[model samples]
Target: MEEVDVVIVGAGIVGLSVAEKLSHSFDNILLVEKEDSFGRHISSRNSEVIHSGIYYPKNTLKAKLCVKGNELLYNFLEKNNLPYKKCGKLIIAIQKNELPILDELYQNGISNGVKNLEIISSKKAKEIEPLFKSCGALFVPSTGIMDTHKVMKKLEFLSEQNGVLISYNTEISAIQKQDDEYILSFKSDDFQVKTKILINCAGLWSDKISEMVGINSEKNDYKLLFCKGEYYKTTKYKDIKHLVYPVPDPKGIFLGIHTRINLNGELSFGPNAYYVDKIDYQMDDSYHQEFYESVKNFLEIDFDDISQDDCGIRAKLQKEGEKFRDFVISNEKNKGFPNFINLIGIESPGLTCCLSIAEYVEKIIE
Candidate 1:
């Protein structure tokens, strides 16, 4: 058996961020991941766009963390000599009726303390992005993109340098609280560990981890819905600068399928969201028409110009047609579990909010 002061389950960005930040104050800290390498799932997948804290409601964790995280992440990336671009973003309203949504987003963004969010006219938008089709656009200069893989690598390096032990290919089969410490059992290798503090940042399987520790998901409304979003890469559009997005559905459904530009100056559009029962990453060509139709209104592309590229699953707290739910990050002392912190339903902006989320958990513990 191994003994440690703190054990952080899941090596996703959120977990790794927490590990790196806490390593400064805590000793004998351990980070365990089921995968052989770090960030194989929710962390690596989806658009690598650095958000501007525009979409979330004011004073919510999503807005605050993302707004603060946006700055922290940029500084971290630059300070670490990582690759990134402040390419800016545009949320366009193709329909006249959607103009109000832009206003609402602008107001919400201003209230959330997002910097330099201006609703630009279609003429101004065309000056910035000539290929875009828009009636009006919310110009968010703070939004950008980064090398997510490199960012995670640096965090892992910093944590290890700070004396945090990260174990790969180790899964927590079961967890039980004995006295004040947590006893974690592994699936194989006859491995078990004990830690005084347990931090659950297990992105997709976080709810199951909580249940193992006797916190009911339904009772706490902490259940996660697996929303699968698929992307399509374009061979035609590479020079288009800035991230282009549609006005988000206010019903609090999914963000519409939008554009993604990687560091190589390649362009892709996608992540049409839908609910799924199981964890699956297999891309389906059956969505070719849907993908084309979704983007045709914003981008000029023939159906053949786009091809299925990749997909990722979002562990959302909101089910299909459910209203918005803020990220459920809490230290569950009131739930009779002290020294236990749970982070669930961290979806969009999780990447941008990774470091701030860690700082948030650090505040909870300190």
Candidate 2:
């Protein structure tokens, strides 16, 4: 058996960030991932949009961390000379009935302390993005796009340079708490580890990881519902500039499918949401008509403009038709597992919230 001071599961951006931050404090740190490389799942998929903390409600972890992470992420990008674009974002209202939702988003952004949020006329919206159709829009200047792969790679570099050992293709099949240490069982039978502290950052499988440590996921409302989102791309991006969005789902199941611009100045649209029982990333044209109908309200394009691209699944704490659920990042001491931290339902603003999430977790250990 191997012993380490700390072990962090999941090598996604959040886990990598935690590793990099904690490396300065802990001499012995291990990061384990089931995938062959980091960020292979939720971290690498979907739009790499750096959010402006606009959509989340007031005072929640999503709101606070995202608002703070927006600043921290950009600072990290600039400080590291990473590739990114501060392209701004426009959330649009296509009809009079939707104006209230736009206003609601603006107010929420203000409540979350998001700066430079403005309710702009359709004219102003079109000026920023000529192909977009809107009656009114919420302009978020701080919203931007980034190369997530680069960001993850840089974090991986920093973590390694700080002497954090990352074990790839390693999966922890089971975990047991004995006295004050956690005994982790691996599927490969190659070796085992006992850590003084465990941080479960396994995004989609976080709930299952919690279960391994005697926490009843269902009893504690930590059950994760797999929500799958698929994307589409188009060459019609020639005129598209800034990021554009439709009013989010009122149930909060997702931020509505919107225009996702890449760093290359090309545009892709989609990530239409639906709950799924299995994890699958195989893309299909099943939602073609639905996507065409949705984004056509906000973007100018022919029905033939889009074809299915890639897809990703989110491990959300909110079940179908459920109310908004904040990110479940917490220490489980009172639940009887001291020094064990569980990060569940980390979706959306998670990319924007990575650094702040790391700081919050580090504080828990300190």
Among these predictions, the greatest lDDT belongs to 1
Residue-by-residue lDDT tens digits, candidate 2, 128-152: 8777778988899999999999999
Alpha carbon lDDT of each predicted model: 0.91, 0.90
TM-score of each: 0.98, 0.98
Error of 1 at 122 (Å): 0.9
Q: What would the per-residue lDDT of candidate 1 be over residues 1-366, giving only the tens digit for each residue?
A: 889999999999999999999999998999999999999999999799899898887789999999999999999998999999999999999999999999999998999999888899999999999999999999999999999999999999999999999999999999989987799998876878998789999999999999999999998899999999899998897867888899986667677888899999999987888889999899769999998898899988899999999999999998777788899889898888888999999999899999999999988873
* lDDT of model 1 at position 38: 96
RMSD list, candidates in order: 0.9, 1.1
TM-score of 2: 0.98
